[model samples]
Target: MAAVKGCQFSASLSGSCYVMRPRLHRFSVKVPFFDGPLRSRLVSLCCHNPNPDSFIVDQTVPLSKNPTHLPDDCPQASASSPSSAIDFLTLCHRLKTTKRKGWINHGIKGPESIADHMYRMALMALIAGDLPGVNRERCIKIAIVHDIAEAIVGDITPSDGVPKAEKSRLEQAALNEMCEILGGGIRAEELKELWEEYENNSSLEANLVKDFDKVEMILQALEYETEHGKVLDEFYLSTAGKIQTEIGKSWAAEIHARRSSRLKNKLN
Candidate 1:
């Protein structure tokens, strides 16, 4: 649409674009999206208010004089604003209903949701004790958010044939979108940092969370095997040598021992 005179258009982080018109000569609308003579004209109208709180949006001025067409809720840019935080929370609700595709595709009946998987991983983090240099709180946070991106991108397993780089890119984009809902504040940055750390598998907490992830998978596999009388040895094969923490390794050993004893007893 063509630009309107005495009005400026800008893109909002909420994925919508809108136009604002000055309500009074005392305040100026900063339209970062415009260019050329129009940009200079709008710049001249922008008020240099020392107090940020004084800046107000004139929502009545629509992008193309069509007020009804703009985004329903005009969200504030402040990180601490309730609108942004609420938007983020609303996005997280999807994870609770989205099932983990890996288990479903493997023919595991009544597979768990993504939230269910993360819940068990978080519990694993909570009960984990006495790691010499590890921070258990960090582990819990990492475990909770590790699969958060899957809420947006869904669970992409190795069997999906997506390249590792491509999968990472997709998940990262989804994570960024999710964080954007939180207004890209300190909390958002921390979430990104922990998620990246888990992705890299380089830190102690990350390593512990990674092992916890595999441990959760194998434990679930064992449960399915016993409950359904189906052999899920492939899950064991996948995690055989990948667990990183001593605690994880020990848990894996116990899980394996129990499975072996059960099979041996059946044979006898």
Candidate 2:
């Protein structure tokens, strides 16, 4: 059996090799499975198998002589394109945190937007949660929108002594508003859950993201001080020391010392 007209399956399964061995012209045809040189094989087959009775093919109809047609609807109908793109920019626009571009005016680089932070925290959680009993993907998703309420309430950076009840009221109102923000789609509901999960920090995933949230802010504060001056934010240090996990405590110490040194250099 040999392939004919780029139909390798046909050749191997039933037909014979159609190539003249010397004539090697490149030909291509779009078939689901079979592939080979079609024009070269066909011409060779026709030339060599000149006898009409030998090579068993329906010679009355030439495969190459068919005309292709576009349906009438093809010209008039619109093409279906993908839905809107969800890049960092669009995510930023949706988040109120980045509404003030001045917040990112500093030299800190990782997450230029709140969405960027969520996206990366999710990534970090995925990468870090190799420990037993942790659902990495769920944790990643939990991180992606943990601060969605912040998108509405605005960042309450610990310095603002807004009473706990007041902040809770504002943040809860914002959270409730988010239920309707995207019209209660699965995505919006999932984001709302992320906020709840983070706030509760009951599950291992939530706890991991909680750590990441603190870590991200500390990193941002360090970045801000680097650009501005020694100026370590007092709020960050106070919260950092209270973190129970030694993993977090160690990270705080490292950042605190690092920022303190930066502050010293600036003071000079």
Candidate 3:
């Protein structure tokens, strides 16, 4: 059994209440019984166990407080409110409208949007073969969020001359603001964590998602090369030998094979 320390027990006409504070979150436990104060005392005695791990704590507690009000320049919405959803979705509209800078710079017509790239990555994650100890669902979620900050920061490519650290800082700030607009609930916290995981390459899921990112780019480059009859060796060279996961390497190899075949046929 888990021991709970510093639990405050109180009696009420309807039931008994106990408040438990864990390492990072708080839990409110209530028990209703027809008995009187004696039952409440007995329950409190049981709560005094010395093993902390015996008691299961709910992790659904909100990590941060939602803003009670919006700023003067923003729409009026509270965290977890309907208006907040609308406002956040409105902001996300930029993702669908902003074209990827790489394609634009290459003189490709009708380039894919950032959201379009993320959606395909998510689909890649969905259809990925099962790997031992890897969380496919987490990979899918990471894929969706990996480029979400681009909605505000735009696509900062290598040619943009922005320092890597500066690009990360800008994206982090944008992600934080987006989460704040989302009303700072569990979902918002999740988005922040997923984005951080991908940014840091901290987990297997993050590793896979990163590979998917490169694979997606190279695949797009191949498609554009075929459509526009332009050689995009830089894209392929940039991603060469950088895929960390076996699945990513396999997918990239297949795309490379197809591109090679296409180039050979072009010579004929």
TM-score of each: 0.69, 0.53, 0.74
The residue ranges of model 3 lying beyond 4 angstroms of the native Cα positions read 1-79
- Candidate 2 whole-model C-alpha lDDT, 0 to 1: 0.54
Q: What's each prediction's clash count? A: 1, 6, 6
Rank the candidate models, highest TM-score first: 3, 1, 2
User: For candidate 2, lDDT tens digit of each residue in 1-268?
Assistant: 3354433323321222222221333442222222353221222333233233333332322223321111112211122222322332243366633632324343344435666667767766766727678788887778766766766666665457788778877887887775554444334445566677777677877876777777766776777666655354653855744565444566667877887787677679
lDDT of 1 by residue, 38-133 (tens): 221111133333333333454433333322243333222224468888888888888998888878887877888999999999999999887888
Q: Which residue pairs clash within candidate 3?
A: 2-51, 2-54, 3-49, 3-50, 3-51, 3-52
Model 3, span 1-268: residue lDDT tens: 2223564444332332222333434443333333543322112223433345434432221212432221222121214678888989999999999999999998999999999999999999999999999999999999999999998999999999999999999999999999999887556877898999999999999999999999999999999998899999999999988999999999999999999999999999
Which wins on TM-score, candidate 2 or candidate 3? 3
- The superposed Cα distance between candidate 2 and the true structure at residue 199, in angstroms, equals 1.2
Stronger candidate by lDDT (1 vs 2): 1
Please give the CA lDDT of all the candidate structures. Answer: 0.75, 0.54, 0.77
**On lDDT, who's better, 1 or 3?**
3
